[model samples]
Target: MDRSAPPSPVSSYSARRGLFPENEPFAHGWLSTEGPHEIYYEECGAPSGKPCVILHGGPGGAINPTMRRFFDPAKWRMALFDQRGCGRSRPNASLEDNTTWTLIEDIERLRVHLGVEKWTVFGGSWGSTLALAYAIKHPDRVEALVLRGVFLLTEPELKWFYQGGAAMLFPDAWERFCAPIPPEERGDMMGAYHRRLTGADRKVQAEAAAAWSQWEGDTISIRGPEARPAKFNEIDFAVAFARIECHFFMNGGFFPEENWILNNIEAIRRIPGWIVQGRFDVVTPLASAWALKSAWPEAQFDIVWDAGHASTEPGIVDALVRATDEALRL
Candidate 1:
């Protein structure tokens, strides 16, 4: 695949692409890992099609049925699994032994269990972070990568969204996000939220979880909070999503160093990859994607000018679907 020239912005053309029709998974089940966690996985698309693995965002974000629509059923065999504590995975919302490294191992376990030697990796947000870490660790197992809303889990990125940079743009939502924390604790927002998210009081944890998840739900898309799905506010989903996300963010993604992904870019330099980022994505933002493209020049980068962080946005859906279709050549 030639990636000498950067791809055009996904929103440039009048004709827009949409997700493939909804399809049922050909095979679905739970895999018990070495630890107490049991991962939920489902295979969609053709049984004999090109193998691909889809990684959902949030460190806590569970896989949804809509994610399976990104690939053509006739040409791609996509496998999607909920990370340790999210979705249908067992011991819901438990944080024990749920580091980035363990998740990487879970990917490998799933791969071997499925009898696939190599496959394409698709992820967005924190999913992109995990994909990069997994690819860096086992580049030989990755056939290609399709990433969106790139997040490298750096301190500046964390401070931007969690602290004040994003707040400058969404003061209304920011106020709501900060309402849960007192003025004294607001200075260290992540720390404050982490305390409450992981606190002994179930009420405190639930309150913190709702606030954390709601803030993200409120800001993730260009359409704003009202446009976000109602699932974002559900108590069960909010608890797992917020708790696990705060846990990962507080732990610095469990990377050995701050710029581990960029520092180790050489591991997958020759691999064919595409990065699709939203121009107005306050959640993950564009700087991280730019830095990633600069570091990995071989990968094609497509900026969606009118979109935000959510993968459900039309422009993002277009870019991702096109990227996956293009990956078929690989």
Candidate 2:
């Protein structure tokens, strides 16, 4: 496949493709990790077909049904799982032993346990970060990569979203994000939220969780509040999402040094890859995607003009599906 040429814009067509019809996993179960955590996983699509794994965003984001629609069930054996402390995973939201390195090991464990030798890796947002980490660590096991809303968890990226770069665009939502923290502590928003989120006071934790999670929900879509996922409002989901995300962000994604993903890009440079990014994604933004592309030019890069950070956006859905379909030929 000639990845030299960028994919034509999806909006250029009369009709843009949407997600595949909703489908359930044919097989689902929990895998016990070396530690106390037990990860939840499900498999859908053809039992004997091209293998692929879908990594959901949020470092804390759990798997959702809509994620299954990105691939052709008849042609792709898709695997989706909850990373460490989110979704159906056991000990809900417990940050015990959770780190970027542990999650990468868990992915390897899942691949071996499922009997998949080499499979395409599909991820977005934080998921995209994990996918890159995993591919770099175990390049031989990855056949290809499909990434969206690229987030490297770099200091600047974190400062932009949590500190105030995104705030410049959504000041209203940013005001609410800052409301939980006092003016004095506003200087370090993530640190302030982390202290409250991980603090002993349940009331404080819940309050910070709601505010932190809602902030992401409010700005995730180009369509605004109406398009934000309703799940973000639930306290249980917010706790896991905010806590884990905060934990990772506060700790610099547990990376040895900053810019780890791009520094290690050469490890997977030969692997087939696709990067789908939203032109107006305030959450992950376009700069990270452009940076990744600059480092790994072999991967196909597609920008969805009408989309934002969320995968459900029509343009993103079309571009992702098209990327996955093209991976089938590999």
Candidate 3:
């Protein structure tokens, strides 16, 4: 299939500097978590340009240079980093220093490290969750938000993604993911999968990781195809996937019950924000996005018909670019 091409400037920059931009690459480095771990990140664009921080999904997924496309190199400086154990962050899959709260703190540390008073924020999927969490916690530090594939991290959202509605769409993948354990053990997915996927058996671990990732890929591109799907190999699959999933599950996605952000909307509403969601998004369903719009009708919410969880989705990407442009105006 011929995927829709991105904006000409986007494609041009991608070819020159990577998927992000060639204007100027941020010096490569790490920020002390001021704890056991250090967060790794890259910056680009002009130092004097308005700050627009980009957050990548996956507690374990690292930010890509491609993310730089959301902002104009001359107008906005971009900061991209790996959260805690994900991406360039030290000690991959180290449960000792990974969690939602730890990530929130890391963002704070990042802002301080960068010496930015406030900046527009951009994120998708899990990144969206982090953006919202950060915005609520420190609304003063957020200039605006460019959110795509909004993951609210509610129980319904979690259950659907894990073993409920979304699972029904991928029976084959679900069956494979669940096949390792017996019917009785099925109730304890975390325990059973953790034991087997992390066990010494290489075959057992690979199968589990593949099954887990297949479902995620399918959901990420609900309406169509994602240009870049995560590549999960046998060695990195089991431990990484298991760690992220089990962490979210055990901690209830690092947030409380449904409408966790509802009560706090009034606080962040004063800040300009955009909600870009796919109409058929199985990962972070459009329903939640709609609810968010209902709470803050003034918020810019675009329901892109031809997209899904992946930010690279044509419509989703365009919406983000537009959002960033609009935020700059405000």
Candidate 4:
């Protein structure tokens, strides 16, 4: 027990942020979406325990195994899945039938497929948008929500990141992101990027995909220069991510109406939710999360001061774990 001596292995614990240890999904499989598209999904923790779901970011981001760790295996039955056109889903990066509503339908379909009665929904970044959309659409099926780095997918929020607002914080990264498109096309970054990302030229698509993905990686986490950005180099993964993200953002998330989340808040007001946001999150910004909290004041909100947009941040990881635990209602 010497104060200065290294702690023994039995007593030692991970200095990593978050209360939960990294765990693996015990089972996984593919859920076929409408058409040839198949969505990849996994299950972890006790089969008869409280239900929970992980809504991954990127609109096209894959579900990381580490995301399964947020819940205690003994206390929860958790589900994590990749949206259409991303992750282990087949037909890598195909944009056919991929849209915001398509994803919401996919979620409900996954739940029915899993036989989950109701679940505490967990999502961050674009995931949050999907989570909210799903909750509003089917309030009876949602037990609760744990949202991080919230993105409402509003037109103004789109402008903040793609247009000029976030550029104020990371001018260098923004410069690189904007460098690919001509000035005339700069007025619509999403439209401009979509052209190259979906264009016939593989070389051009790959280039735009990397640049688009890198800009997000570079600015998302406030980690030091030594910390590596999330890997987005795989051409297929990059292209799908960039293209789907641009596709959603350009079409304003394909919402039936503007400010859709707020407009439909009453439907989800009774469904409890907790927001964990980074104060310095340039990717989605804290303001949007705050606005969501304001609209849905029934939800719990936390602002992590030292974190950025990535849920990988220590503060966010811890907050998300706590929220997941809280959702159990025990």
Candidate 5:
């Protein structure tokens, strides 16, 4: 289905590298975590500074250059990595050993590889999911958290994304996303989309990809009249994106049948955290952020009044930048 949400009324994507000058010529490389996969990452800011890892969204989305702006070069060392089988990483969406547990383990391995005893974790959307899972598994290794668009991977959240919960706001996009297939296929939405999106017919793939991208874009971002269609590498982006999300969806996103966050609330409650949510976020509702606040009453939750899901949204980006700066102070 079209999972792309419209960009917020916010003006444009965040400027890259302009925020930090001294950290010129950022470094990029791969880290072999001694696991089944190699992770692609970029390092900016000060090497000897406090360590802060940034996780990008999408089970398959690559880390953009703007992500580095969240950190203060003089105060914190910033690390951004495309998760396994994702951007920069080899074997994109290979599905050999990619799962939530594998990703959690990957973070621990990355920590040891980076030679850090403890470091702060910063992530948004699916990245937030990985951060929480990693922290819960190894609480002592996490100094703090800066979570945005917090997603708990609960059944309800999954239903909202795949089913019709958010359709009220973007029914046109949703309808287009599901149009490539027959009515019978709607029940197994992702499965049906996967078949046509990966089918031999170029026409079918193009239609499915466009529809899916448009649907997601409409809800997440506010499109302008002059906005053109997004052009993606079908094999590299569309196929991999579909497989990874489906892999997680069919398996219920690797979360326990019950809400693990609620089940283990007491443990994560003590961890220092800042929850950032967009008041108008259709991808992940504000309710999830409030629910998280209820579970960890001490953690500060910031609501960006006019923003949606995209971190690049002006208000949300500002909050994330502030969160990064806050982490550096500690």
Candidate 6:
């Protein structure tokens, strides 16, 4: 297989289900969420329409310009922001006071600042994790939820990807992912990598950061081989990404308890949730998604057989676009 080529999408989705035409944000600005860090936010589509906040995945990934196309510009208002140490947010990659709880509050502050009474929330992967946490804590403010690649961030799920479970399926990539650490350090991959990712050694940090980011790409690329994709554009971005991700994973996402979302399902039971997951996602597997759906039986679930962990997967894009359309009825 040509590892260099992009994966062929496996889907029966029609062109009609594709993302809406390219649309620029109507307004964009940075909101001061904490002492020195400002959450970078932008509003797209109709300013007065049903607002839906889109949380970009990664404790590090920023919202792409085209992401707003998932919603109908005429009927939906899209609000997107880069959490703590990511995107255009200042003090980039500094983990000062960054936590899952802080992100949840940032969402609320953004909503309050925008004066949106209640709005739909959409997220994928880590974004899904934050969305659920926010909704669970402030259910009254969430009109609905559209989640993709549900990630509960449980101990089991973390081990699956970091320790060995996901490694079994992608041994080649796993081999590379484990290559950076010493034999003794393999037992604690996150801690081992976190050490280098945050160390004072610039060379060590960049190496670990590149390896960490490539490992993620390999696991999510449904059609690619286990190989380092490419050098990250900047060492700063890579370090921040690897550092923040490892930070959250190391701290169990800063949750007060494990399975917090599942334990507090009652809060969002009537909040009208929609779950879209890829059958083959290695990062946040179907098991996590299924568990979430089981805990919140009222949320509609869609399993995209042809997709993988990436929210940009073709089948996933179709499902997400339609999911946004469904929100119009609410």
TM-scores, each model vs. reference? 0.96, 0.96, 0.86, 0.92, 0.86, 0.93
Q: What is candidate 6's lDDT per residue for 1-330, written digit by digit as tens?
A: 011223458523455377788888889898986577888899999988998899988777778866788899999988999889997887788888999988888998999999999999999889999999999899999999999999998999999989999888889988988888999989999889988987899898889988888778888858664322332446676777888999999999998899988999888999998899888888899899899888888888888776788766777887888888988998
Poorest stretch of ten by lDDT in candidate 4:
1-10
Clash count per candidate: 0, 0, 3, 0, 20, 0
lDDT of 4 by residue, 20-96 (tens): 66667778899986687998999988888898888989877888767887788888988988898888897788888
User: Whole-model lDDT, candidate 6?
Assistant: 0.84
Score candidate 5 by lDDT. 0.74
In model 1, how large is the Cα lDDT of residue 85?
A: 95
* Model 3 TM: 0.86
Q: Per-residue lDDT of 1-330 in model 1, one digit per residue for the tens? A: 222233567624567689999999999999998889999999999999999999999989899889999999988998999999998999999899999999999999999999999999999999999999999999999999999999999999999999999999999999999998999999999999999989899998899899899889989999877767677878999999999999999999999899999999999999999999988899999999999999999999998877899999988898899999999998
**In candidate 2, residue 2 scores what lDDT?**
28
* lDDT, residue 15, candidate 6: 55
The residue pairs in collision within model 3 are 19-66, 20-65, 26-43
| TM-score-better candidate, 2 vs 6 | 2
Please give, for residues 1-330, the per-residue lDDT of candidate 2 as tens digits: 222234476525446677887888999999999999999999999999899999999978899999999999999999999998999999899899999999999999999999999999999999999999999999999999999999999999999998889999999999999998999999999999999989999999999999999999999999989888888999999999999999999999999999999999999999999999998899998999999999999999988877889899888898899999999999
| Candidate 4 similarity to native, TM-score | 0.92
lDDT of 4 at 238: 82
Q: How far is candidate 6 from the true structure (C-alpha RMSD, Å)?
A: 4.5
Model 2 CA lDDT for position 253: 97
